[model samples]
Target chain A: MSRHQVRVLVVLALAAYPALYHLLTQSPVGVEAETLLPRMDTMVALLYFGLFAVSFDFISGYTGYLSFGHAAFYGTGAYFVVLVANGKIPLVPSGTPFMITLLCAGLVAALLAVGIGLVSFRLSGVYFAMITLGFAQVLYVFVRGLEWISSNPRDGASVSGSTHPEGFEVGVPFVDGLNLAIGPLSGDTVTLLGHTLGTNAVSFYLVGAVVLACYLAMQRIIHSPFGQVMVAIRDNEERAEAIGYDTFRYKMGAFVTSGFFAGVAGGLFAGFRRSVTPENTFYFLVTGDALLASIIGGFGTLAGPIFGHFFDESIREFLSPAGQGGGLLPYLQTRLSEGVLSAEVGGLTVEGFIEAALNGHASLYVGIVFVLFVLYVPNGLVGAARDRLGGPVTEKLPDRLWDR
Target chain B: MTAVADPALADAGLALADATPGSVFAASVLQTGFFAGLAEFLRPSNLAGVLVNGLAKSALFVMIAAGLSLIFGLLGVLNFAHGSLTMIGAYLGGLVMVVLVGGATGAWARLGYFLVALVVVFAALAVLGLVVEVGLIRQLYDSPPIYQILLTFGVTLVLEELVRIVVSFYGLQPISDWQEALGTKPAFLARQTTLGPVTVRGLALFEILLGALTVVGIWLFLTRTRYGLFIRAGSEDDEMAAALGIDVRRVFTVVFALGSALAGIAGALLMWDPVWGASVPLAAETLLPAFVVVIIGGLGTFRGTVVGAVIVGMADAVTTWWFVNVVTWTWLPEVTVFLILVGMLVVRPQGLYGVEEVGGH
Candidate 1:
């Protein structure tokens, strides 16, 4: 299938899931379709991957500047949106729409990127990467010092019941087929589609929309003429300069664009989770996620992050034993050991054996996967798929991942 | 957008005015090519309270930076987990010490026990670092440098959570009977000297010497030793070094080990510092400041890192002094580095003394 076809299918699939869940199930526990979306954590995981993938794919994928501090933008946006939602900031309005908040967040982070880019752009390669990281640490410290930023964020905590705590309210309410009774300027309750759709579903859908919007915009940037210039500069900076293409402007432009998308991702994340702390907002892991997405998905390709997001989040989730009885290895054992009758056909229940084999190291599974991916499958899912298909059907994508 | 590789290379002329410590000498120091400006040495209590703080802080930076520099230079791979490695070493060292000392018998009673702990730290971390290199980092030597970061990053999260789990577990399951019934308190100074205008801790001076010795030792190891030559050769051209019959793989594995050992040493030495303070079971402040010192000095330059460390240490002391005694400034403490980092990035991108990665490096 072509890139466009895959995109259409993915979108249609996402759109269909919630709608189907809406009609079939009329609220599980005063619950609704949004809350009961299959693997809600997986959806959140997708948002996190999508955000970084947008910005990282631009510079790392397109421009070839291996930045180590893209999290600065995401964190900045996250802190701002989080601060506003918690009524911590005086400059911004509290409890604003998630979309408006995302724009503001993007703008703020983009502004910071502009300021940082102005001074640090002169240093090329490793120096630039280090400078970016150093500056980010400074930002991290700054955020950590803000007592306002810490608000015990519910890590995508689900709200299935009709009655939430008095303090709990969805800041960005996606009210449809259900009435949301607002108590003046105090708190807003979301009765999503027939059931009282809790804050989690509202935040999840809000974040999903923001992440999708950012991803689409980044796709456009990847195909833009200016973005092409950024890639040219990455390929051979001096050559681009020699060819009279103002390489500095291209690099800076990419940096700003990347920051803008990163901010959108952050804002959405902060608002979605209904809280933000320094640990959650400014994690190096978040930066790593973006870097991994770019590397694994195949750099300089629009479809790469879409593909990379699936692998980085879904595969890790598959490996992870978070509140689950089995992981990929366990499932594998069951699949091989029990075939469809692993419990019924294989005629044996071996959940305990699988657990014992795991040996209490969930991260070990994640680490092994990461190491193997970098070493053996460096071009990532997109690259591997492209190779198998004998090059990209899209003109914008490179035959090789390192076209930049 | 302001994007420049080295704004320090392109001089940002933001001059100061009036009578202050740095104002008069600043013109000649920054404007003139001569390295004439002194680091504004200790004057208040005569023993370098500020200077010693600065110096010890420099050592801290040197400890982490030297390891980071070695890995980056030799392997041509930026160990993303270097910071995480420092954190791991610190927590591990702390756990060992706490397990020993926090027990009824006390850790200081058995000095040999401490030595054994050091050996354990070295072995464990060295093995861990090698595993990282062989398992993940080895592939990037032939491939692009970008993937090394991603791989290390993947490892970093796994390790951080693992350490968090381990540390949290140690709290639940205290090391059983770690105390060896040796009521020994190792030679930690209960002495402070008031000399001339400097107020110095006895331990501070020892740390300064240790830092100096480390720098001298590292300098010799890099420039004068055979291993040092091979490291330089490898950093310059790994392909060439390998072709010249040097086992680049072994060199890399050793470099990773040495780096991990240095981080371990840093974690151990930190026990004697003032920041650890009176009655804290475990401290996390060490790693936060470690990054500051690394950034203040350019990444990869050991001596520059020492200078950066000292610069921050003194700044912290002086700023606190100014905040408490003079201006009553709360925000000035954090701004010190913000101002300094911008000044460093804008004025000297290779740090004060970091030799720029010459040519291919």
Candidate 2:
């Protein structure tokens, strides 16, 4: 098939999965509740993040310099979008539509990326890692202070002050003791290009759609001269510099580009959730997740982070072994139990014993596995796939799982 | 060399310089700054109380971060899951203490409980560290340090949620039974020493003594022995050291073991004194400062770790004392540390004492 055909097919496949998942999980098809509407938005947000995360793969994984501090941009966008959506911008009368909020989120994140990328782009490897990590942490802490902008009452606006607090103090009460304004909400049925599409399914599809766009953009960059320069920097900076490449600009571009997706993801997250809080954004772990996905999926490979992202999200749930044998063993146990039942020998049942053995302490096991993965499989699933596929190291395989 | 020679003297001047000034200082330092300022701890009687608490708090952080610094300096792996390790140890240790207190029918059982629990923490952590080394860190040994860090961080996330699950099942949070169990013997500040109303804790003496002993043991282990020399050598240039007939692989495993053991030991001690809960996310807090200490004091410098820990401990103690409730400004602690780190980075990037090693570009 042609590249465009392949791209269309890829989009179809991705769009179909969430709908399929919804079909399998949610009873009855597409009769959404008001509360459930948020989930649709949230799915969109995750899709946005997924797209952004894949974009991150371009700079971090493709370039081989991992940054665990992108949350600065991500969180900045999330918080900024909420501020903009709520009309939290000073001298502005009120909030904007959710769409506008999303734009502001991306713009602000991209802007912040430019600023941070300027500073952090200088270092590489561990030093680069530390610089980025430190800056993100500083930013996370700084935003927590911006409680006024995020969801603070002292920002000359309160949800209750805007509308009225029924029982509590303000608007929609958030997780950590903050409330939102009643209704300056500028939402107008989730739409795209004047099409009155089914938002429930389309929201997630839009996420995939955006992700595909990001993937293509990233592909273009990775193949472009600038991107090749980034790879050169990653491989051998000294030689690159000696051969005379202003590697700094390349690094900055990658950093900012990586950050742009994260910001987009953050904005989507805010619009999806309809609120933002320090609890969600001000965490180093969130940044870690993106990095983990990129690494595990395979560095510097377009298809790597997608595999990493989905695999990470899935593995944490399945292999966790904490939540009652949720992964492989549980499926086996269910099937096995269909045939017969075991009598309790001691104080514990067979089920209880199995639960205690595996599910009881999932983190302990997950930790062991994570450590084991690093020790054994450094290049992650994508690397393994590449090696087995028997192609040139950087080129895609015939039916490459990572590639579209 | 001042306190380097006399460990006892080192404990005094570093009584923590509470530089924030008065009540504003106290509030900004501790979450309980309000109660302490308004009533319980601000009185003349409580000035001694504040000093005693401040000293103890400093000592606790210093000791915990010291071991963490050792591990990071030697291994270059920031075990993000160290705090969880500490938390697990504290929880288990507290359980033993509780069982001992309740079922003290025989003295053997009581003694057995303490010994067994100590062994449990140390052994568990050592094995855990080994597992991590063999499983994750060993592979990343050749990759960029970020891979190592992220891998550990992934473990930390999974482990923390798992811990929450385990705790919820066991009917506990991170810090519930620790205070009561460890603080069984009420330790008030001894009123004898009248140096500006700072009376030291009887327990504080024990902590200081232990800290000194640990410092000495580590010093001897690294400086006066073959294995110690191997450790120092490996930290300097692992490839060259391996080339020179030292089993660098074995050294990596051992260092991880030793480092993890130290973390476990710290957890055991922390559970009894101050670190029973998740509130003191000891790993993250101690990890940063310890890394800073390891860097500033000189990476992999055993002597440097001590000096660095002392600096961090005193800073933490004084700031914690002066700020918690005193300043009521959330940004102060972070800002203070950021400033310290920035200053250190500008003047001494390899750390205050660290000699940049090979393998890290």
Candidate 3:
């Protein structure tokens, strides 16, 4: 298949996932499928967060400038949306459309990126990362202590019932028919083609649409001449400068562009969750999560982080304790006989062993995988796959398979 | 917002101010204005207290950052897992103290036990450092410096989670300070000591003494010992040092071990302090401040780390005092530290004692 065909195929597969999950979980072997596949709600989270990761990759991966304080932009975007909706921000009314709020969020984040980048891009490597982190941390602490954000700013601000009782809408601004409200509690349900989609499914599709739009926009930039300069800057910045490319300007541009998208992702997150917290949005760990996704997916590949996050979230859900999402522990409990479960081994029963080893300990296993990935699979999943295929998946895979 | 204009507002403000020790002055700053507040804050007692607090904080900062600076100097790897090592030390030290101390144990005996705990934690953490350096960090020596950071970050996640699991299993709250461990402190260290016009925590004096001893010990080791000379030589130019028949790789391992040992010792010290006790979040809390200190001092320079720690510690102290006495913002202290870092980077990216092209390598 051609590159475009491959791209289309991937999108089709992603589009079909929720439907496939729904059908598979209802089938005879539904329990097994449920144990493995991520739920619709998790997918919704993955879409927005995955967008953030992709934006992270756009700068750090493509240009070799690790924006360690990338969470600042994300937090700014998230806070802006929530604050605007609550009518806490100046000029922007509470009843303003969500789409406009999201746009403003992105623009504000981009402006922040420009301010940070002017100072940061002067340095390289660790210094750049540290400076950006310092800026973000300052913002994080400042936001956490702001009394006007809410009665308790440390816990973060929520979409107040007095202002935004209905869920934040996703679609054309000021058009009720086109826009779909998204939240677990307040989201809209839809019926089409004899299949009823629940709130989560509707949210999944709407959020996915926004994520797809961002991805396509970013992908276009990556394939442009501007992207070539970014890659050049990454490979040999001195050489790029020697060639009179004005590498600093390109770097700033890339940083601002990525910051904008990250903001959009954060805005989507606020819209869906209807709440914003400094810990979740502005914390260094938030940036770390994006870094993890970028690394696991394929550092330089624009589309890779989405898949990487999917893999990560799946693992987390799989190892998560029973009840919330189907996991190994819950699956084993129902499937294993009582005698086997109680069988003693190394001073603990089989059930006890599983509980001790795997229950609520997804981070341990995820961390191990991350370590292994860093050590061996340094190129990450998509990068390794591309390496194996001897070219980009889109361009080379079909040629290799057809022996052309 | 106008405190003097409205009686109810004034009363509420006064009540809020009276709720905390230094807030009366803060309320006065609001009621009486900035100059009067400054006059009240300039009192000898307050100044002396802040100075003492700053020194004690600087001592702790130096202890935590010294190891990180040492490893970065030689290996050019910013060990992200350094904080986790410190955290493990806290728990390990706490474990020793809790196990050794009894209700009948005297203050001197408790102090003696703490010394033993420090030694034990240092040794154990040193071995861990050795294992990690030889096993995980060694593999990524040839990759980009970013990979080294990534690898250590992965290590941090694993270590924290493992600690969490064990802590939870032992029926301890991983998020809060281990109160049982706090209860193991010697009575003398927990009490206040008056010196001339100023009164300070007994623990602060002990910490200052320990801090001084640590500085003297490390200084002697770095300046006087053959291994320290080797480390210095290696840090300057490893290939040249290797060509001179020095085992650079072994030096790297030694530095990594030493750094981890230092972090562990710091953790042991923190376990006794009430403000920063043995907790899971302590890793990030200490790690960030350590980073700020190292960066402000210059990434890998010991002298720079010391200077950086003092600067940050002083800033933290001043901001904290202001938060208590002059400002109502709760995050002022924390925010100031990061602001200083950002300001430092903008002003001098190379840090106080850092070379022009340190991180470039």
Clashes of each: 31, 34, 0
After superposition, the stretches of candidate 2 with alpha carbons farther than 4 Å from their true spots are A1-6, A22-45, A91-93, A97-100, A145-199, A315-346, A349-369, A390-404, B1-58, B103-120, B154-166, B174-196, B199-205, B274-285, B322-326
Our model 2 lands, by Cα RMSD against the true structure, at 8.2
- Greater-lDDT candidate between 2 and 3: 3
Maximum-TM-score candidate: 3
Which residue ranges in model 1 land beyond 4 Å of their true spot? A1-3, A19-38, A41-45, A82-98, A146-206, A306-363, A393-404, B1-43, B91-112, B164-206, B232-249, B271-302, B320-335, B358-361
TM-score, each model?
A: 0.73, 0.77, 0.96
lDDT of 1 by residue, B34-82 (tens): 2211222222332245455556556665675667667765776666677
Q: Model 3 in CAPRI terms: which quality?
A: medium
Best model number under DockQ: 3
TM-score of chain B of each: 0.70, 0.74, 0.92
State the lDDT of candidate 2 residue by residue for A254-335, as single tens digits: 8777777777677666554555655466466666666666666676677776766665545444444533323544554545
CA lDDT, every model vs. true structure: 0.59, 0.58, 0.88
lDDT of 1 by residue, A293-382 (tens): 665676666667656676666555554553553345544553465543235424324453343334345455556566677778877777
- After superposing all C-alphas onto the true structure, candidate 3 shows an RMSD in angstroms of 4.1
| Per-residue C-alpha lDDT of model 3 across residues B25-84, encoded as one tens digit per residue | 234345545675576557787677778877888899999999999999889999999999
**B355 in model 1: Cα distance from truth in Å?**
4.1
Worst 10 residues of 1 chain B by lDDT: B1-10
